[model samples]
Target: MLPSQSNPNPWSESEPAEWSHYSDLETLIIEGAYSTKQPQAILDDYYIDFKQKRQISNIDSNKQRPIKRVQRKRDDKHLREERFMDLPVGTGRSFSGEYGWVSPFIIEVRRHLGLQPDQLPSKDPQLIPMLVEKAAQGIITEAIHIRKQREAEKLAEVLLEKKNKKMKEVWQCCAYLYTLESFLYKTINAAMRLIGDKDHEEVWRSKVGTLGPFCLLLWDDPYNTKVTIEKTLYRGANLKPEQIAAYEEMAKHKNEYRSFQAYTSCSRNRKKAE
Candidate 1:
């Protein structure tokens, strides 16, 4: 008869301690607060209260705190006594050569079998087949587990499909919420960009063709790709190793240098002519 198949429990025995602690902290902070009040505002109030209490305690403590004196001489003597004065005698050779070239494989096999490295019958060729058989059995067991896992996953997918079909309203609500969030995000981003562009234009007008600030503002403009600036800087002055490397990478696809071999060949020919 075939072995009885059982579904393994997917959930762990306990929720992670750190996650539980964080949830408790969140609950504590949000407890009794109006939903309209921001969490950050509440947290800031709590922080200020804590700091005021700490300042009061510091002001109240007039007397100097007691300082512990260290006995350096005694500590030094103790450390010296504890320290190793001499190294152990070195053996001429460490490893046994008896096992030959197969020693490493033997050690690895023994480790997988939960045996000590020296426990395997390294000299016996007959035991090799037994080891191979044991390894094959382990592989077969793992493969069976993997097959069962795939079956469980397929079953889960089918159940999920049915659940999703039943929760059409819930899915619609989620989609609506996501759409609203995305719309708000894009609106805010667009508003910020408009404000920034206006500010940059005002700054550029105030500067009125001033080289440094105008160049900086020009570079800061969203429309500018900065490729021209990068190339100009790369050619004109010494740059950082990272900047040089980036330029080299960008140079690869540029019209001037299509490939490393092309660049190298040109350089080599120039050098040969020189």
Candidate 2:
């Protein structure tokens, strides 16, 4: 005869299960459920807020509960298995096999999915070479697109550097022109003071017929230079008719050609202060 089993759990019928004993297990279970449910609740609240803010039509004012997707363990497994079974397999071939074909397009679908000939696991020999060729071409096309994007980024960087350099050069050119204008004014004034002071006869004699002390040379038909100087002077100095007339009178008494420097200097100084 088989031995009779003794009652091992003596307190099962006599006492209630202790709350402290089950506290940790219950807490863990509750925390897991809360974590999963919290996101759902948040989404629900957001939807409610959105609906409340939106204007409802009289034809569709009633609140309808969301239709949830039914949970099916078998369906999920079947879908996953189908996807795994559908992946393309490769035969043993050389790197540049007759099977390998290039894509007509630069960007194709296979490469986008990260598929490569070397990465395939199967060695099935029955499939047509054309299938592998097309797949390979697709992969290569995606790679080409990625490479082009990288190259474009590099080219953009080079162009940006060149543009910044050009901008800096322009700023420098403007600053140089401003400094040149200021220097020209000072030299003209110094030359004029010397010429007007008859007491300094020797100094006036040496410099009056020449360009100002700072100028390297002057040309008889310096047309472009003259236009630039005139424009600069007009913009720098606020010359009135009376002032222009007075300068013109002085030019008649002195060498007319030599008067250009003096006129420009005075005009620039007057305008600059204003």
Candidate 3:
């Protein structure tokens, strides 16, 4: 049987650091859960106190400047209740489950019976490409499973175009493992001469693997990079005609963006990042 799913994960769902808000009730619950699961050593390493989160919240509230402003959202919620008291229509009728698609706890509690489960088996970064390959079993032919090579090419394209701090850090961390030889024999290779080639990719894969989606989720935070990639990067997959048409429709749809704050990742490439 497929893994049934984590019944009650310490993270609630594996929330990327970007979506974490200090005041969200769901955030409180998840963090509190992890506070229990977190190894004592990790807590000591981070200098977190070994106390109930309730007590920790009390201590931190004195220094927490953000808590002063969160009362306004509570007031707005009260106003919503007062102005439109018709239950689901005014409060709970969220066609989108509030902001639950990206973050958590935007839906009204009455409407939130159970949460959508996290689909990944676990959040391990090393197994990400394997997960994608398993998920893509029937979709494509054998030759195109070179996830790392494509990622390296994408990394190369980004480095050559910008050659800025973020890409520079990526190069420092990865160039030893991800070598693009198409430009190697002729002129001096500026993008750090690759030590390994496509022929020995398993060697590189064992070293660095693909920059898996979990890595992306962790490192893509602006707080970690101080800047993020704005240019479009493409990843191609074999798509049926109907799938292409469906994606074409999605491409035309406008998406609304919302900004929220608190917390972060560890990009080992840069000293200041995490």
Give me the displacement of residue 213 in model 2, in angstroms. Answer: 8.2
Q: TM-score of predicted model 2?
A: 0.19
**Candidate 1 root-mean-square deviation in Å:** 32.1
The all-Cα superposition gives candidate 3 an RMSD in Å to the true structure of 24.8
Candidate with more favorable, higher TM-score: 1 or 3? 3
Candidate 1 wrong stretches, greater than 4 Å: 1-114, 119-122, 148-274
Candidate 2: worst 10 consecutive residues by lDDT? 91-100
Residue-by-residue lDDT tens digits, candidate 2, 117-175? 33221222222132223322332333243342222222223223333233233223322
Pairing residues by index, what is the TM-score of model 1?
0.15
lDDT of 1 by residue, 1-274 (tens): 0011111321335532121111112223333232344422132112112222111112333311111112222233222222211111121211112333332222333444455544432333333334333422332333243342222222223223333232233233222221221122122122222211333334323222211111111112233333442331111222356545756666586544211100010112332222
**lDDT (Cα, tens digit) per residue for candidate 3, span 173-215:** 2332222222111111111011122343343233122222212
Worst 10 residues of 3 by lDDT: 184-193
Clashes of each: 0, 2, 1
Q: How do all models score by TM-score?
A: 0.15, 0.19, 0.18
